[model samples]
Target: MDKRGRRRTLSEHVILDAALALLAEGGADAVTVRGIAARVGVAPNAVYTYFPDKAAVVRGLAEHLLGRVNHDRFTDPSQPWRDRVRALALELRAELLAHPGSVHLMLGHPPDGPHTRAVRETLLATLADAGLGPADAADASYLVNVHILGSVAFEVAAPPGGPDVGTTRFRWGLDRLLDGLAAHVATGPPR
Candidate 1:
């Protein structure tokens, strides 16, 4: 039964939606089982029925947010590898920036859900297509992930003069990273 004394259907999605709202309103710490339950008009235990605990709620939120990122643009074989990489980074940045309050959830608890894995796989394939061997591709993917996550974290923490400022900084850093990767590829496997 909801707060109004009428029975309401509750599901994981509903709970996650409430949690996300709380997170957006007051950051990660605000997303507790009780808080979510209240938001969704359910008892606190009802939240646990869908999520075992707060960590599970956080993970769900991370996955929910990651699911919003569009990685298809990066999977286009016709596009240049650098362009594909940039598309992916931009997509991730856009999603993270859209939910600035949830950036810490992403940084603190990386999601290993299907959406996250698909994005990672796309990045790995992009690097491989760019001539990076498996090992180098894996390392390069890590570097790219770190850069995107770190940059978004900074932008969220201290918003630049404007959206364009952060976008410019992000593009510059991404370009430099790609430049190094390109040089590495051109040099062939380390002697």
Candidate 2:
């Protein structure tokens, strides 16, 4: 309140929250400093105090979105590991599809943030449950990641705004790929 003028922390969180809300409501393009400020009941400059640009806010929102995935239904420990992995992938794909523009923000972003690291760690842990060793876990985790991202990209890019193949066909694709991938897992440490 002194030299800072505005309550920057509260303003930043508010702005980030507004940005996510905007993304949820109108996809990526809807998120702007002005839009966030309007939603947060603050001036645009207040939002600017937190984020230098729309892109920075979007990156922060992307990180927030990744954090949500870590706690979502897909990470259920009661579910079998393979089932959990598939469900998580499907859930994430669905979320991205539902949001649309977040798909692009997600795809090319660097995996350097905390939320991203948590998601990756969770994924790697799930892969280890599938009997992958440390090295195999890393490799297979990345492979499965690529599959999920690639699949989601197609889902987001599809003309129907979702996959035309449906869940059965889509899951079938995962099954065929996993069947081969699991062979490598089975050979590793033998469980």
Candidate 3:
């Protein structure tokens, strides 16, 4: 409602941006519908007009962040498949690290959104191209995704005493995982 007797206007993008800002400022707990509406200068119920509930808003924010991942770097065919996979992981890790407050909200969430789906597809395809069968590729992709999520969550939550030890650890862990995948491919899995 306004002086002109019109209801306050609120777009999905505006609501999502406000929610993301709240998430960046105070983690997932701060992105309530009421809070978003207030941030957008609308009545509390106005946010619901776009997002059904707070969970929906959180999902939107996570998807929004995932959508911003640099997929091009991972899809470049000129690079070795392993390097492509590693670039994807690093880019995703960098994004998650950039928003430490939002890591908790995103860590265990399903990758059903479009952007997350794209990343998943690319990862699986890369593994498949590197000689992994369908089952192996799917399994490996899931493991990689889980590793990135868990690793980033721990790095974000770690006590502020280390001088970026997580970076080395991440590279080491990633290389080990890739090595395991390479070995599996080389050994051709027992028939």
lDDT of each: 0.86, 0.71, 0.82
If ranked by lDDT, best first, what sequence of candidates would result?
Answer: 1, 3, 2
Q: Stretches of candidate 1 above 4 Å error?
A: 1-4, 159-165
Which candidate would rank higher by lDDT, 1 or 3? 1
Per-residue alpha-carbon lDDT of model 3 for 75-167, expressed as tens digits?
A: 766678899999899999898888776778775445358887888889988888778988999999988987898888788777899546487
What's the ranking of the predictions by TM-score, best on top? Answer: 1, 3, 2
The candidate that achieves the highest lDDT relative to the unseen native structure: 1
User: lDDT of model 3 at residue 152?
Assistant: 86
Show model 2 residue runs off by greater than 4 Å: 1-10, 24-26, 70-79, 161-163, 188-191
Candidate 3 structure, TM-score to reference: 0.90
* Pick by TM-score: 1 or 3, better one: 1
Residue pairs with backbone overlap in model 3: none
Instruction: Quote model 2's TM-score.
Output: 0.75
Q: lDDT by residue for model 1 over 136-157, one digit each (tens)?
A: 9999999998888888878877
lDDT of 2 at 9: 51
lDDT of 2 by residue, 48-167 (tens): 777787777877877866766754555666677778778777766666666667767766444357877777777777777777777877877777767766666676567865547456
